[model samples]
Target chain A: MNFIYDPVPWVINWLTQLLLGWGLPINLVNTLLYLVGAVLICLGAMLFTTMLIWAERKIGGRFQDRLGPNRVGPWGIFQSIADMLKIFTKEYINPVGIDKIPFNLAPILAVAAVLAIWAVIPFSETVFGANINVALLFIIAIGGLGEMAIILAGFGSNNKYALLGAFRAVAQLISYEVPMVIVLLIPVMFSGSMGLNEIVQAQKIPFIIYAPVACVIFFICSIAENGRAPFDLIEADSELVAGYNIEYSGLKFGMFFVADFLHAFTSAIVFTTIFLGGWQGPGVEQMPVLGGAYMLIKTLVVYFLMLAIRFTLPRFRIDQMMALNWKILTPLALVTLLVTALVDKSIPHEMTLVRIGALVIVNVLLWLLADRMITAYRKRNPIQVVTGKARPLARPEILPVVEKEAAQ
Target chain B: MTGMQILFLITSAVVLFSSIMSVTAKRMIHSALWFVLALLGVAVVFAMLEASFFAVVQVLVYVGAIAILIIFATMLTRRALEDKGDQFNRATLVTLVIVSIIFAGLVVSLKSWAPLQNLTSPLSAEQLNVGVLGLALTAPDGFTLPFEVTSILLLAALIGAIYVAYERKEKKK
Candidate 1:
């Protein structure tokens, strides 16, 4: 609509005009523009990633009641820049006995995986990389590349600890992916299209308001996917001693580090686009910069919440992580998807308010019930908070069947 | 040749090369990785055919799930990680001949079918009806029987996997 206001498309148009003016063929010009667009998107994502790392650290420090990165440039805005410089100077160590090819390939592929997802991300009304119809599926496929990177990093290192980390990555990532995919289906169903732009446009009321359970499931699963704290068992610093990237050092290690931070931030943006009314704030269409601004704010809000969760919650035992995914989140997501789809189908599309209210009520009730049940269970079977050990029963009552078996 | 035709040839070459490498890689894990490459190449071919849905699904299911599972299985097996054993057995030559015969027969069969050999019919992507596809999958009087049966089959497989993995505890009297 407001084509003149949209910077990205405007730039593309201007660039194409300039190239055509220079006597370049139309087909060649189109291809050149495509390459230029891809390069711009990749560079933009990488540049944004530096800020995300700085913001994450700054926000983290504030949350933890400490000043972070104050020594660098003003408020440490240049902290990531400094870190980037340091990483470049660091030696790229190839550990003895490590597979050279996969070892080298892993980190680059990891960063590439994150960069590739930008292809389908709808930044504003007129700005996107590919505008793929099956953006969600495209995301899931790209996720495989990330997991493959972890596997390669772990295996190529030839370290048992790294191998264990890789195993955890596969287990946790794949398990969490199931619930994430299921919850993702709600947005697709609501939008009636798999395209991210369509999903964003479909949000008359944000999907989060309509189905908070899916959003929560998506957030939790996404946290696991990113291997952030609580679900950070894959690279549990306390346990695995840097996990899969233990053997990696210097710039290669930095790539993995950057990829991890970028992935979490990218997912936050994805969350914003899908569940929040991303760039849906007033004057966004008329002013494309405003759309980008709205997008950033929404992403930062989610990113802040994610950091709040990461710093607060303790890491999950691998068993607990699996149990949470398979036993609780997967079933919950499936039921939510089914119920919402059924309830949604019966309602007329124009009655969005009613549909949203119905779904919200259902979700809120479930949340309350789950909370109460958890609290009840906690009270009935109290555990020592300090030791994290279960309290013994006051009465030593045994099952008769067990007693009979013991006697036999 | 057209750019698309050149792209298609490159994709096919990758697929063929990777499939051969998948069977030939000494380490089982390496073989699995090669298999992943083959699957990805096939997915690219699907994309070339303008079937974005299947291309995405192929990568999601085959590369993401199956290839990983294969690698995971190999890791679980003894010495499969750095396996140095010969990938082929004593009957390699006989088996190779048999496989080659089958491949030639398939090529002959495909060439005989003019309708199947024609490549221009699906040049452009059809305006896909995802709703109809979804309905056909789950709706009665469609593919519901096979869909329901597949669910049951998956449930059976799940139970079988769990049963295999389960360690025996105390016996019931």
Candidate 2:
């Protein structure tokens, strides 16, 4: 791979080494190196997003019992490329009565926010964007910018539906964001460092096992935060007519489109690293090249898992979404946090057995409690009315009649 | 200029420019964006100090969270972005003048105050290790008070935000 004139990586490596040799300190050199990594990350994210769009469509098509994108290249591998070209060459129409400045700025801000957060994400042990100790917070905080961009896009479009959709998005984003940050703190607590790489390494057992409730909350929040399906009421296409980007067409629309797909990819990566013991495959790290490959495969698998969830689940009502977070995730996260702390305290540092036992006990108790709460709450106040006469007191009414005539 | 001095000059200018824009920008959203730029410049200054963690925190907390929240607040306030009247006036000018005077006084004091010349040297690996930051946050003697207080602050912020955003509505079908 480092053979005759690859040019880019070679030149970068050479230049970096030269800087180091010229009496430049290692940290200074690393800072300069990070600039290069940032650009590469942006490029990688774009490529991955494009691929994901194709993969998701094909997978979704298969799920729906249809063939997808069979025309473009072999098995439609190049379909996304064609779509990109179409989007690029399409006419850019600035709608009448729109706020010109914010309208244009919103998409740019959205894309930039996503890309900028990658600057702190550690790709591998050696390969990193930047080793900032506050990387975890940086990722979450930068992610908040995307919500602002969405709100701006909605308002800027000057469309009523867009405005409504944007408002919905803002509320949802801000709501889920509370629990999301709290769940993220679970990792930060265990890692005892805010750096993403250090956080990954801290998971001797993936935080998912040690803190399953936090894991579930984080996953749900990530989906909600990214405006994906089941939680994607903000862009409920059937209801809001493409949501915030209703008026946007051509490149403006493309920006939102690309942002959505890229967001999913990034979310998948985050979920994998935070909860799935990032890049930690058996015997993969021993061989440098294999490690990178394994990491990519794992990431792709996670991305597919997200896609599967997105396509499978029905969209939640906005109220249902809010209720789920406030009633379920927030309380669940709090309990998990307390349980983790207590278990961590009880585990003697010397005995692995005690630690494992504590972890298991905490997990089982959490599941039992959460399951009971969900089911009991559902039973006590069901989501809907049956519109039928009341049943006999002792009759098994789990399957209630939709409609019944009175005995005449 | 040496590299460090050059970095200092660029970042200082960036900070100055953005700070001015943040105050004077006509649009509230523009003002927020300018504030983000100012915070970014502050991060660069932290980088100059070789406090990489602090640099990232400046961006994460100030640029990311604070500025975004400010933008959110601006959006929530009805018609804040539509070029409005009297964002600045005579009273604002007076306030600016007083703030500038205080800033100058502070700068003068800082210039007169002795800096840690010995500690101005580059960081060692041990000092920069990720674990060191954790120790600083959790250690009883170091920043445990601030850390606990920040957690409390976050909780308060959450409650305050929920309060501000809460609406008392007429019960209706």
Candidate 3:
């Protein structure tokens, strides 16, 4: 293999030889390499957040017709860096009457949960952390950790508002996860594997082509999962006072902030990997490193779409959000999964184009049917308009008597 | 000790410590969190044993869903936040004696188990594929009956839960 095209194996070989030359045991060397790889991925993700924050803010500003952080640096590129510096130097406040241990642990767990997801995502061929078989499940499981972090933050802070926010966040997360997991099954069913790398490899034609409904639902659910705007009831400032992280300040707050931004980008990466045929484009077969570029491009497209949605849409009401998840998205996702599975199973694998066409047609039909049902439901139960009669004005005749008495 | 054994020992320690903390923590939320840790330690043990499917499922189901439910329940129920009463109750002695007797019996039974005496070779990565597990669970001659039964049980519970939670409105005049 060309070293320029695929440097991971080459670098590993060089390191292995050097370590052996230094008389290190093989197992020890392997363990060291694993640690280095893990640390590198974590640091890389953390560092990537600087750029992500800058991009999100700049894009958000443009969407809102304003210039965001223009004075900090060129295009305000260094603004996140300045913000990071400030956060680093800020006081770490431990609120009085707080549960000390979980309070301290929550932010770290928040960041760690997001970082743990990076381990299973295959960036490119031969360039990833562990290629575990149950990567998709691992992602969901890590999401559970994120939920735990919010719970811990809320419970530990000893603030009612914080607890309320955490409760709402968890409720939103857990509710949305049902549809998310259901739609996730479509891709796994299509690819016949749960391993992300294997899924990517199996996508000769992207799974999105086969299952667009699932893709849309997955995107919506992922946004809800990340607790971004349109679904950002987690930190609805108008009500809950910054949600679960209200009591957190300084770097602890910063950690939660970083996790939020990273999670958005990570979800995009995941969407790319599963649906957009990650790292699969022309010339990728010859130059595996080119796959990384392909992956980045696809991820950016999805990430931009997410940002656009975030900046444009207003947040959902808590009841509306729950209704969407259970009444609409969950049922729709189940039908999609069922239809896709049956169709895919019945059709022969050799008839790829036919299968794709059939699945797409079915999906469009399903979407229309759901739309029609929603419209009918709305018509059947029109919003009630309560217009009570205006109360009669209470004119006081005693004011004239008081004026006459004053004159006398 | 080999690395694997050392890792196993560390995992066991974590599991034991967390389990103890889960039962002994004064605050209910802290106890729930400790229980989650103990579940995670069990997941790690599953991973160490090369049952990646089981490990991931354990984390997804036990730590993710069940533990979260427990915590939520603890939080929502009035006066469930903290235990102000004495740790040991009047029946502690009797409970301890019965627990020890059961533990001793378990130890003896486990020691006498033939499978424990002869260690089987670990499965290869191919043999341990999740597809294999799926097949085993679904195949007619395998665990199809038990799997179907479990799912049916879950569906029943779900329906029962919804029934319990549902409220009937009084008729309008």
Candidate 4:
């Protein structure tokens, strides 16, 4: 293979030879290489967050009819860097009565939990940190760590508002995870494996075509999981100042901020990997490096779509959010998974066209049926609109009486 | 000692220490967090054993769901937070005796087992593939019955929980 086309293996080979030449043991060299790979992935993800923040702000500004940070540098690209430096220098305010260990550990765990999901994602044919067989489950499992971090931050802060925000966040996260996991089963069922790389390779045609309902549910659930807009009650500004990180300041606070931005983009990357045929395009086989480009392009598209949704939609009420997940998304995802599994088994794998057609038709029909049911339910039990005549304006005579009573 | 053995010993130590702290911690939340650490240590042990499926599942179900629920429940009960009562109660001595007897019995019984006497080689990567585990769980000739029964039990428990939590609304008639 050409060095330019697949530099990762070439670099690995060169390193292996160099380490051997230096007379290091095989096991030690392997361990060192693994550590290097992990550190690189972590650094790459953190650095990428800066760009994500800049892009999100610019897009969000456009959506709100304003110019984003333009003075920092060309297109305000250096804005996040400036913010990073300022945050680095800011003082960490330790609130009184705070639990020292959990408080200090929370931000690190928050960022680490998000970064851990990157370990299994396959950016290209040859580029992945790990090819663990249970990658899909690994993703969900890591999410638990994120939840723990939030709980720790809130509890450690010893602030009532922060605790309340954390409760709301945990509730939303746990509830949404139900549908997300169920939808995830659809892709796994289609690919017959949970390894992300194998899933990517299995996608001769993107799984989304075969399971659009699952795709949509997964997308919505991921957005909710990230606490993005429309499902962002976790950090409701009017209700809780800044949610779980309300008492955190400086770099601790910055870590949480970075986690949030990085998580949004990471979810986008995951969505692309699972649904949009990650790194799979024309000419990818001939030049595997181009697969990385394809992956990035697909991820950006999904990221932009998420940003659009975030900017356009209003946040859901807490009750509405829970109801949507439990009453709607969960049941719908279950049905989709069941239908997809049964249909997939009965059809012969050789007839690709027939299988796809059957799946698409079933998915469309299922969506239509769900829509009709919801519409009928709404008609049967219409939202109560309590209307009454406007109250009469207060008279001057009444106002005087009220003033006299108050004085008394 | 080999690196793997050393790592295993360290993990076991952590697990033991965390489990002790989980029970002995003064604060309920601290106890719960310690419990989580213990669970995570067990997950690490599972990972080291090459049982990636079990390792991930342990973290997902135990650490992710069960531990969080326990912590959430403890938080909801305000009294639990301030509880500074003695960790040991009136029945501590009796419980300790029973636990020790059980531990001794387990050790004696397990020591005589043939499998424990013979050290088997670790499974190859192919043999450890998750697909094999999945097939064994779902195949008709395999563990289908027990698997289905476990799912049913979980479903029943879930429904019972919802029933207990459900609020009844009185009629306005």
Per-residue alpha-carbon lDDT of candidate 2 for residues B53-106, written as tens digits (9 for 90 to 100): 777677667765677678767767777767665576769878989999999999
Q: Write the per-residue lDDT of candidate 1 for residues B1-173, one digit (tens) a residue.
A: 98889999999999999999989888888888888889999999988877788899998999788888888888999987677997779999999999999999999998898887665566433455455678889888899999999999999999999999877786532
For candidate 3, lDDT tens digit of each residue in B5-59? 9999999999999999988888777889999999999999999999988999999
Across A1-408, the per-residue lDDT of candidate 2 in tens digits comes to: 352323344666887889988999988887777776677788988887788788889998887678988889998999999999999999988988898877998899889888876676656545566667777777776776787688779878888899888878878987887888877877887777777888877766677777777888888889888888888887877889879888888888888888888888788778877887776666634543444555577678877777788888888888888889898888887788878877887777578667767887887888789889899889887889537897667344543554222211
lDDT of 4 by residue, B1-173 (tens): 89999999999999999999999999999999999999999999999989898999999999889999999999887677578878888999999999999999999999999999987899898888988988899999999999999999999999999999877676333
Q: Which stretches in model 2 have alpha-carbon errors above 4 Å?
A: A1-37, A97-99, A385-408, B2-7, B116-119, B123-173
Sort candidate 3 into its docking category: high
* C-alpha RMSD (angstroms) for model 1: 7.9
lDDT of 3 at A323: 81
Off by over 4 Å in 1: A1-4, A372-408, B122-126, B138-142, B166-173
DockQ of all models, two decimals each: 0.57, 0.44, 0.80, 0.79
> Relative to the unseen true structure, what is the C-alpha lDDT of residue B144 in candidate 3, on a scale of 0 to 100?
99
- My TM-score estimates for the predictions, one after another, are 0.91, 0.83, 0.94, 0.95
Best by lDDT: 4
TM-score of chain B of each: 0.86, 0.80, 0.91, 0.92
Better of 2 and 3 by TM-score: 3
What do the candidate models score in CA lDDT, each in turn? 0.86, 0.79, 0.91, 0.92
The candidate maximizing DockQ is: 3
Any residue pairs clashing in model 2, and if so which? none
What are the per-residue Cα lDDT tens digits for candidate 1 across A176-248? 9999999999899888989888888877578888889889999998889999998888878777887999999
CA RMSD per model (angstroms): 7.9, 6.6, 4.4, 4.2
What tens-digit string does per-residue lDDT give for candidate 4 at A1-408? 679999998898899889999999999998999999999999999998998899999999999888988989999999999999999999989999999999999999999999999999998899899899999999999999999999999999989899989988999999999999999988898888899999999987898898999999999999999999999888988989879889999999999999999999999999999998998999889899999999999999999999999999998888778877887888899899899899999999999999999999999998997798678767876876668987766655556776768867
What's the lDDT for residue A64 in model 4? Answer: 85
